[model samples]
Target: MGFTVRQIARRADGGEIIRTRAFDGAELSVGRGSDCDIQLADLGLMLRHARLRLAGDGRVAVEAMGGVPLEIAGAFVTRADLDPGDNPTIMLAAHRLTLARGEDGGVLVTAERVLAAGDGSDAASEAQVFTLKKTLPSKRRLAWGLVVLILGLGLALPLWVMAGRQTVLPPALVTAAARNAAPVATPASGWQPDRVWSSGPLSTAHAGLANSCGACHAKPFEATTDTACIACHTPAAIPAHAPAARLARGQVPATGLVADVHKAFNLPEGRCASCHKEHEGPDGALQVAENFCTDCHRGLAARLPDTRLANVPDWGGHPAFKPTLVVQPSLTAPRFERVALAGARETSGLVYPHQLHLSTRNSVANMVRAQGLPGKNGLLACNYCHVPDSDGERFQPISMEKNCAACHDLAFARDGGVVRTLPHGKPEQAAGIIRDFYLGQALSPRAGVAAADRRLPGSEARLRTLAFTSPAQARAQADAAIAGIFGKGGTCAECHAITDTGGANLLTRFAISPVTLADHYLPKGRFPHKRHLSYDGRTGDAACISCHSGVPRSNLASDVLLPPLSQCATCHGGPQLATAAPATCATCHGYHYGESGHGGDALRVRLVVARRGE
Candidate 1:
């Protein structure tokens, strides 16, 4: 009998082929010619565009047709197969070959498995047929589909339901949700929600509340009965549980009472909702009336302090009340003049020639003509030195180095020349001389000495008496004597005095007074008084008069001109004016008047010493 290969089991290189029944329940001989390979004729059909179904058991079965040894096992099936050169014939399984037969009787299929013949047989075999079943989809794909459906329902259907429910919710419930959703704290992030007014159409006004409505009102659409609104929104009651809420009300205990009065008169009962809306239109977060505070406070001004309500005058008919001051703290009145001038007076008894230094016009004009220099550049007005007062009378301290030294060329001597150059004698000796002169002058009226008793006991005689004492004792005595003479409250009138006529005098009429040698003798490099007197009109006499003008109305100082430099260039300049002038220093040494033409021997020393010390 010619049998097909049912199921071929074989090993290569001379092993026996085991046979099994084909899918058609037939058996056949196993042989090499019985094996066949299958493939799809139309490859595009494998892709699933539409659902596919199987005939039975969700499978399609194929059978071996021709008399050839064939076999089928698991997913494998075989049909007739030809020898290597015999027209290449093949017996394909029907199910594995899914092509419509042409007029020439050909078949096509996508072979899932191949079968081989174990024995050479020309008969059909059960192992030569195979069946193919369509596969079921995996669980993961089904699960993903279900999830997509659920998400679609959640997004679309719930939104539709919420839209309908929003209209039906009682205003109280909606308001409760809004109030609960509001942030409890004053957002550190400073985010504020727009306000909504209930007066207008809800649709028109609700646009402003698109993202949030709880930003402004405590509760959105709730029953805002006067009691409920006043409890939280008004300033009168203390916000019990919420500190942020209290701050939002902006009504501190001191000012809250004032706000209450405003609400009582200006805003009516049911109308609270009008101005204090929950969610206003865009740009309505801070929309309270600016005059809300002042409207009520103006009537009660009599009861409040001027400080509490800045005393703004009512200008004719203009409304004087402003409410912005109540809300913004930075707009308060400025504090009036708090700077005092008590620490700016002179510490020394030297009378600053405020008036004499102020007369610059004549000196400046004459100097300008003589020097052929511009008059404008010669002298500055007095206001330059004595600064004006904007708010009140106040004197600023004069800088000795800057203002005084410009003309006086004097440096301040703290311990009466202790640390500076000595003039005509050692500083200690000069200090002693000054101390004795002060004491002798002090005792003169009592000692029955003549007013001309200006000289101290001869230096040689005084030294003979003091020579027997220790140096320490001498220093101590010198310090004591100097202190008594220049000590605080040491009878300034006895030496220095501001006369009614304002002309100072030493013996008869000194520039500074007291006839004491310490104030009398100074360094010699300071002002050259002779040069200043001869300062004709280099920059015009206006420059000379700039600082030498007399005081106005009185002989005291005035604010008219600055100090002049005519005295400085006089002695400091090169060459002498005439041959009669003496060269020896003694000609200008004595304290008496002479034909030497010197301003004064001691006065020159005082001026020069003051300058060098500076």
Candidate 2:
């Protein structure tokens, strides 16, 4: 059984207003404290005044606690018995509690304030004693007075001050001449009352707009419009997330009471100010909450049925990275395909075995140490060939001269005191240099082609025979040398794809296939190497090897050494997970742009594939 409590209050019109509540427990507690089952606001009442419970004789036992006396029927008693169908009134301080039987075989308690209650005959005297007419001013007059005061100071004063305010120029557009010029004294230049209406200090990016309220708040009593933002930020600088129609269809419909209020006010979505809030502080960062992205992207596929993007609720739901790779090798125009890392292969018209070069106990390692190349303990390091770009985010393109020329010597011939080397890139030039050297050697006296010294009287005919055969011999020698240079196991053929395009001369006979290596594998996602310079306190090659575990064992140039999705799960998880680093959508991917070179991949790979055509 439960205890039913009813609190009755008297209105000015002599009507009663009752509030009822039920508490389910074996006993009913009454006190002035908030923790009591039936609390009284009177200070005279003790914290634990009394308790009522069922007795063995089918009656309710009222027991006073903390040595408090209970006044029942004008008699002070420590304890009393209340029977069913019997109404007993208990008086404590200024409260009157009427006890009776409940409808559900429980105790019913009705409490009322009896401080002002008197005999029915002297109603006029009782009313005069409680009236506030002789004590203070009326409540209505005071309330109206406060309302007028607030409107005059908060609204009227600010409007009056803002009317004659001078305009402040944007900080970026301010010229040097304007700074050196003397300040123009005006009445509006002094302290103004409108400054009091400022919410807070502006952020560092919009600090110049602090004194320029009209810059953002174009209309009075209205929020900052997107037009004000577009004035400073051009459409080209900050492009829309997608086209209007598709973005609208993809947007998740807002719900809840707050959303209803916004809809009632006809609030529009996709506003700049909605995400990037201002007037927070001078140096506060504008961190968009993770929910803003997850709300729409969590179930985007259901809303945007035609979209090619997968629904990404959080980092745990992220798909495998698809890197743009050159599927077909070509010199003029290479074919590119976005394939998952598991099936990715790059035909860059070059052959390089990372395992062979990276080994510490092999011939490549011995050659590196013998030549004093960039390696540690005769082992080739990643930095020896792959150097970081200016930003240190990505590696620079590999070069034959800077990286390979030292080990792979191109010297084909040696003069008197000079070593002649073939040109690195120009295959035709290298062939011509070899041909010229052979032709010069054929006609030289050292070759004995036309030598007449220390010869017999009839040796002239033999000298003529030697000169005639020398040209034919020179041609054969040039052809053989050119074939060896451009053939398999040759210096030029070892790294590059040599194509034999026959021509009239030896110089134009061979062609080297063009090589294409993507600077960025994942154009849509950003991975900054500088930010992750160390892994568990391990730096340099150790840190890189932690993520790129397959590089050392990889033997084929076509093998993609990019880390898979599971590797990233080691340190990062969903934004809500406390066990790992929080990874929101914005952490690795930009809303409107990608990595540091915002112009390159950012403009190229727009996030959603549906908007790519438009």
Candidate 3:
């Protein structure tokens, strides 16, 4: 009814290890694979070597798998039947399997290893296996040969090339050489052995110095000198990031192996070439590591107690921005102070309620919609009055005539078909324009008047009530109108701070307080509005509100609407922060605060030398 397999393995110590397992089935598998009911460790045998099944007449059926024949009694057969009355044996490579009738009236197979393990007599010849060791040179000899080859190619050849010629000569030496030089053949310009020392191709900015290494190297094994850099880069072009004395005091001490190496070579902390590394390919020019700035700025206050700058290890550690605000308003020169954004207020000498202007449901928005004024979605938007400058880094100076004039016109009267607008900025000019207009109107005769109703010329009063007003009457009317215009609730008083000085004339009486608005709030940092015009697929008004959330809610023009540090942190963070945009010190600030440096170009230097006839 079932099949039983017994495996007998002989141990090296003359002990027999027998393992017996029974399968309650009509069939059993035999193979070299472990999953087979009867497994063998012979490489010659197929994974599924054979299958044993019990026939209907109680005979054991042996069938070979994968065309592998089974040997039985000196005869090989793919399939064979053995009766219980006659026991039979089958060969499977190194092992032999015997078939017999079990006590349960089922097939029983006993297997044993006939051949011993590790018998390598059938292995390939030793000469074929050890061919590499016999043919090739020894490891030690080959290593020595490589060492000598490297020394010649890397060190000896480069030294020879460097000793033969100086790639670049001084300007003065070049001038002298040109005058005394005779016609001589020069070496073909191509790759030199010394170029092997370069880590990578030269940056685009330093591409001209690729062949002429002496321009920067000057000495064979010494670091580049600042004197060579200063010869061309004028102080105006690359001014110190800060005063040198203060910078030295504030600079953090260098650490680690790299710093130790620099110190060993007598290299100082603040070297020009330290940050502006070369030979890193075209795109690597002017690239500074994030740690270069963070190391010093992280704990700068601890090093220099008198420093005004706060220690900022990352964006999250950055203090609130201190904007330059016009603290004291003056007619000539306004006094400014750097105040933190928390309570910063600017006295621009103007009255404007942002809430009133920016409100969607207010009169300003209604008026804009009714009069077809500029706005986004028929509502007053920030761009209506505020306009970005050419570079979009900051806004253009707000002009009353250009920005406010569309909604708030200055027209007081009309002359024929021409609308006469009061002159802006100058109170004296505005008063004169108004006075002259009234005077001209009073002096002129009525357009539709009857001559018959008029008295004779001698009897006619020069101050005519119905026809023409007198000069004094015209002057009074002009003065009254001028007072109303410059006074509270008037057109001029709406935006400006008006002061009435007691004077005999209308022109000298009214004075408008001067306005001084900051062009840039944080002068030390740069914020490009162009890049921030859109955020998270939101453009136009929505993008603007994302940062300037306080703009619409602000009632006073003096209120600083500049977003706090938290606003920028929503999207931007330190270089290591993965959740936000990476922002390093160089992203907003520059090392060279003055105008950008020049004169590095080799072509320009050649042109200058040509001009000087040297």
Candidate 4:
């Protein structure tokens, strides 16, 4: 009997719908005669890697695994390799095979299992088959129901716990409350406690010592304990006991103290313990020795001879104490006595008479007696002309405009009836005039008036314009003008004075050695001595005592007193001391004159004059 299997419908939509047929009575026609035959053949090829096809109307041809070929005929619907009595089985295709309906509807064809060439058809073979079926349990539904129950319990667990509590506060609030309650105050018990030591106690060895710990130790306790004790104890104390005790009692003057120390041991400005040590410790005492004082005071002391005499006591009028010897080194030969001025002196040098001027007791009386100028009104005080220390040192070589302007008010007349206050010295204006003159000469030398006429514009046009006529003429004229201003006797003593006895002039001395370079316009050195001697005249003149009334001669010459310029101008008019000659600028500044090489001809440039009219 042959069996046939067919797939009436696939299991895609819902359930399986397969059709099977069995042909047992007739010689089982095994061919692809019906859809069931075709289906069986296709199923066999798919599962066994077999190819099946209808050879003709009834016969079926098949090629099996490993290229074995065979033909089979079947109309049975059973597992291809299974008997009908075996448990119903299902076969799935292993490879794709073509199937076609045969002309007759009774046959089914499939690839048959073939035997080796040597094997007979009667060889024993066993065929096995199995059926497949799927069954699902209802446990999935129960699992879903259990999951819902667990979730519900999870949601209600916290609420139930809260409901049981008497006071249900938020977790954060509970935590805060617990923290606050943990440190509640608890009162101390009745018994008192022993003192707790935070720092180590001082060593017992040092406790009984009379000195404080600080006396031996410069730093606090933590500092290194190893330190020298003798450093502080060995040296003498400041302000030795004898002098200090005397000073405390007010028995001796402070100057007396300075003198006594110098006289006894040549201590010079000494007062005990100046260089001794009293407090001993790690950090040494801050004291200097007597030698240091000699460094600075020595110079000053040498200049003023009386400084050394301070130490000498009144030895029953021992002929006005004099210095025993100079304590400091000297830079130049010493002039202990004043030099005399006699005979015709050097014309180019300054002349002064110190004795005549300084010796006069009453300068006004001396002046009245010497000059015999009845209107002179007794000799004037030193401050009347030569200012003293109280004012700035005005005796120095200073610019006429700067020193004079302090007392005299300067006015410059402009084009209209306008007068402007001019700056003292007018350095900027002077520089500008010089620069313009040089520039004009370089640009056009022969364009203006005569070379001698060096003025600028308007009525002074003749002076401003340069009619050099020739370069030689211009050069000669410029040279003459410059020489006239800087010449030895030119304008040197107009503001300064030399004594009739031919003493050194203050201005000349100051010019030689200036004191300070800060004020460029002012001469560096001072001239009070020269001015005093000259104004006083040889017979009698202003006395040094007039201005330096309270100051002793023992003081340094550099320490001379000074007065205001207003005081000097009271006698000497400011105009007489300051004005230049009407026709020439060289009368004031003569050093700045020259001709430029670039110009066609030489040009003589001069300072501009500010006259009332032009």
Would you list the C-alpha lDDT of every candidate in the order shown?
Answer: 0.30, 0.71, 0.71, 0.30
lDDT of 1: 0.30
Per-residue CA lDDT of model 3 for 1-614, tens digit only, reads 79888999887798999999989988888887889888777666788999988887899888998797889889999999888557788988878998888898887889987766654211223244446876778999999999999999988987788878766634543333234232122322578787877778776545555666666676667788786666545455556776788778877767899789987786788878767777776756567877777778899889888766778786677787776677656656666666778887888888887877876666566667776777754577678677888868778888887778766667665454455678788889989987887777778844432111111111321221223459777778778778878877677777888888878888889878887776666666778898898988888888998898887788887998888888888888777888557887777766765421111111111111101000
Descending-TM-score candidate ranking: 3, 2, 4, 1
What TM-score should be assigned to candidate 2?
0.65
- Tell me model 2's lDDT, rounded to 2 decimals: 0.71
So what's the TM-score on candidate 3? 0.65
The runs of at least 3 residues in candidate 4 whose Cα sits more than 4 Å from the true structure, single-residue gaps closed, are 1-311, 315-381, 384-401, 404-467, 493-614
Q: Relative to the unseen true structure, what is the Cα RMSD of model 1? A: 29.7
On residues 1-614, what C-alpha lDDT tens digit does candidate 4 reach at each position?
23243444334364557565544333232223243233333323332333333334444434343343332232323313322222222222321222333234533322222223123221121121222222433678768988887655543443343344343223332343234222121222332111011122232222222123333333322222212232222222111222333323322223666667655553323222333233332122223332332333334334444332222121111122111111111223211111111111111122223232333345434543454433234432334334334334333343435333322333321212333243433323422333344344545653322223222111122223344555556444444432322234422222222122222422122222111211111111122344444333332233544443333342232221333323333333222234221211111112111221110111222212111110
**Per the 3 Å backbone cut-off, how many clashing residue pairs does candidate 4 have?**
46
For model 2, name the residue pairs that clash: none
Q: Which residue runs does candidate 3 get wrong by more than 4 Å?
A: 1-149, 156-192, 201-212, 255-260, 279-285, 330-332, 361-363, 370-373, 445-468, 595-614
Can you write out model 2's per-residue Cα lDDT over 1-614, one digit (the tens) per residue?
76789998888899999999988876888887789888876655788898988776558788999787899887999899887567888887778888888899877889887886453212345456567887876899889989998898888987876676665656453332133232222222344465677788667566555666777776556678887777766566556666778877877766798688766654567677766777677544255667767777789889988877777777777778777676666655666666767877888888888888888887787778777877787778788888987777788788888888766767665454455678887888888887777677777733333311121111221222122248768778677778878876666776888888777677787878888776677777777787888887888888888999989898888999999989988888777787456776666766644232321235222222222211
Question: After aligning candidate 4 to the native by TM-score, how far in Å is the CA of 530 from where it should be?
Answer: 22
Q: Which tens-of-lDDT digit does each residue in 1-614 have in candidate 1?
A: 11112233335684656443212222221112323221122212221111111123222233333432233333333332222112222233322222222222222122221344323221233233331222545578778988887765644544444344322223433453344332222212222222122343222223323333332233433434444444333432212221333323322232476658645554332234533354344424224432332232333244433213232122112222111001111112211111112221212334444433333455433443444432243443433443323422222344444333323221112222232211321223544564454344344322322211111111111111122134445445545433333333322222233232322311222122212112221111122333333234443344345334433322332122223223323332212323223122222222122221112322212111111101
**TM-scores across all candidates?**
0.19, 0.65, 0.65, 0.22
| Superior candidate under TM-score, 3 versus 4 | 3
Candidate 2 residue-wise lDDT at 202: 68
